[model samples]
Target: MVEIDGMRLVQTRAILNYIAAKHDLYGKNLKERALIDMYVEGTTDLMGTIRVHHKSPPKEKENNLSLIIERATKRYFPVYEKVLKDNGQHFLLGSQLTWADVQLTETILMAEEKEPTILSQFPLLQAFKARICDVPTIKKFLQPGSQRKPPPDEKFVATANRVFNRK
Candidate 1:
């Protein structure tokens, strides 16, 4: 396995684009391809925002997380909901699994653990998350050691849960 210690565009968005190209997830035409790009970038931005907030200081983590979550809901949730509403009950691109769905699901699941109430505002995104979790490929990838909860960190998770009334 090749080790990656730092950032690489080739290893990030480009890698996803390459996979999409290989699997033909870019859709059947130019317009559809544009939609795919929209979803991919939206998903990437949401995840990147969460990552930044996740690494912030504890005293300010809640504020950072709140900003990130708020921005995501405001900026991208509607787009995702619209895509799912227009396309079908499968992926942002519909029926077939795409890297966009994979990345979006991962980010949502991680965010859910922190702010479980976040997806409640967007029912379609919630369903999208559930479907992604149900996939064998994603389910297996997310199994066991794939995602480690932030070691309790009750101060943050618990407080957020209480404020949001998340189970």
Candidate 2:
């Protein structure tokens, strides 16, 4: 939840959209928003898969990992790979960065957290990672000690399960 001036924002996508619009990252118009929304939805699905890993039974972790790798490699990555290859732009949509680009960058990073060499088969995506990482704000955030949270670990999972009362 995000609170500003006592107004609260709940729901992840609502906060994302609010921030994206505030920063002019959503898109220039309706058509661009439609595309951004679609791609972001795909990334959200991919992220949801990864999120589920945190909730999996200990014995299921390996299977969860394999499933995550499979979905990212076979289903999701190929779509962005094709988009970046066909677009020939530094970002997904065009020259300027959009929410779609950010979401794609985020999903790529999350997938790589599971498999460091995940992009080996996608040369274009490797290039995209390099380019996105070089962006000033992103570069700073990538530095050690930044507020960026790494993928949840055992401790985080434990706390989340306890706090949320998950089985």
Candidate 3:
């Protein structure tokens, strides 16, 4: 849950929509929103696989990593690569930077942790990653002392299990 002006907000979509509306990151039209939602949802799918990877047992870690790389390369990266290639735009929805761009950049970076050259086959995605990382705000967040959360470690899994009573 997130607290804004002392009122509590629950659910990920509510929190994200609040932020997107406040920052004007939702795009300017219905069509743009539809496209942005499509890209964002794709990344959301990748995030679920990544969560399984971090929470997997040590014995299965290597296999989980392989799955992440495979899904990312086969299912996700190609869509973004084609979008960037065909649109020839700075962001997923075109010239303007929307929430989808931020989400894609984040997923790309997380996937690279498993395989540094994950974008090696997708030149347009490589370029997109570079461009997105160079954005002023994003560049700042990438700095060492920033609030960017690191990949989930063993401790994170333990905490989640403890707090949620999961295995």
For candidate 3, the 10 contiguous residues with the lowest summed lDDT are 85-94
- Candidate 1 per-residue lDDT, tens place, 72-103, comes to 77877777888899988678777877667877
Model 2, CA-based lDDT:
0.87
- Per-residue accuracy of model 3 over 32-101 as CA lDDT, tens digit each: 8888889999999998898788888889999999999999999899989989877765788768888889
- Count: clashes, candidate 3: 0
TM-scores, each model vs. reference: 0.74, 0.92, 0.91
Clashing residue pairs in candidate 3, if any?
A: none
Question: RMSD to the native, candidate 1?
Answer: 7.8
Report clash pairs, candidate 2. none
Minimum summed lDDT over a 10-residue window in model 2 is located at 87-96
Q: Which stretches of candidate 3 lie over 4 Å from their true place?
A: 5-7
Query: Model 1's lDDT to the true fold?
Result: 0.74
The alpha-carbon deviation from the true structure for residue 3 of candidate 3, after best TM-score superposition, in angstroms, is 3.6
How badly does each model clash, as a count of residue pairs? 0, 0, 0
